[model samples]
Target: MQSNTVDVFTIGFTQSNAERFFNRLEKAGVRTVIDVRLHNTSQLAAFAKADDLAFFLQKINNIRYVHQPLLAPTDAMLKAYKKEKGDWGVYEGRFLDLMGERKIEQRLKPEMFEGACLLCSEALPHHCHRRLVCEYLNDKWNGALSVRHL
Candidate 1:
């Protein structure tokens, strides 16, 4: 696992299963969890908000948590992407631009761990914007990034 070969990774927390998600994250040894969901509140009462999740993670596992709305895709950007990519081509560039301009890459470069993971509320990576974020980070910053479901 070369540091230059791998960038950030992503994971989802849908399907109403917290035990499985947290277990996988713990097993992965993820030290920092970045939540990219525009709205962190979930319909599922348990995972309702990012603050609560952060508190739990910090108190129980000592993992750092951050909610980065700048990394979240905006509605305008999504519409433009849909038009440009014809709905299926995930808008990787827009997100990359957002993260890059906001210094997210610079900020994350030093914080990235072997098990760092970006989180959202989509069950599957393909069904979520996280796919685009992961793709951009993998293609532009590092090549070995992986997106997984938990």
Candidate 2:
């Protein structure tokens, strides 16, 4: 790895079982798993529940877990997109604006994300805020982060 490059990863647990998820993180050399979900304790996210997931990650993969709701979209934004079936473009724009407002580029230390994987509930990264967060920060950091989806 280049000295100036940050190895950042993003993953979603919805379509995966616990075995696959933990194995992927372990294989990817992820040191920290950053929970970017607004609500991680939902019953639907069984294997990915905050407490249990953290415990599993440590025990199984020797990985650390940290939840940062600051990287998540507001509840209203999620409801509009998921429940109301709102436009992706509109929701994405609002989310980008929200990220700008949060000033994550300034607030989140880059060192914390080094060798870190961003976690969400989406099955894939294309439509997930974790992807947006990665792209946004990479831009801010002049492409210093090399983002990989797992």
Candidate 3:
């Protein structure tokens, strides 16, 4: 991604206090939150289901939520990763296809907001698929993308 062109931030809810997480997001002025978890359900009750979380987000006007199953890493990808680089290359390739062929960038790119954040259950970006996703986006955008952890 080009230096100082656009910024992309990755954040996780892993073991973090939910209230603090949401509050930090609010403080960050994120307009759109994309949930990347293949299984949106979490063992933790607060982040368990998407519907309830979406409803809570709706209460905060101007904040939108979306889930992209295409972007989510599949079981097959996980299994393959175990035997391969385990760097999420396969999933990143699929994500690029979705963004390019499926026109996900055109359909879901944030325009009204200054920033967006990808959401998942893991708190560490490097340990999560969001790192690969961010790397893909960074390459696609030709270094115009920046990633920050929140």
Candidate 3 C-alpha lDDT tens digits along 45-117: 5743688667766675366778767556666665566456566556566655644664544444333213777
Model 1 residue-pair collision total: 0
Task: Write the number of the candidate with greater TM-score, choosing between 1 and 2.
Answer: 2
Instruction: Report the candidate with higher lDDT, 1 versus 3.
Output: 1
Which is the leading candidate under lDDT? 2
**TM-score, per-candidate, Cα-based:** 0.71, 0.96, 0.71
Better of 1 and 2 by lDDT: 2
lDDT of 2 at 81: 99
RMSD vs true structure, all candidates? 4.0, 1.2, 4.1
Q: Rate the local accuracy (lDDT) of all candidates.
A: 0.68, 0.91, 0.65
Per-residue lDDT of 1-150 in model 2, one digit per residue for the tens? Answer: 567888999999987888898899999999999999999897766779999999998999889999999999999999999999999889889999999999999997677788999999998988999999988887887887888999
Per-residue lDDT of 2 in model 3: 47
Number of clashing residue pairs in every model?
Answer: 0, 0, 4
**C-alpha lDDT (0 to 100) for residue 48 of candidate 3:** 30
Worst 10 residues of 1 by lDDT: 82-91
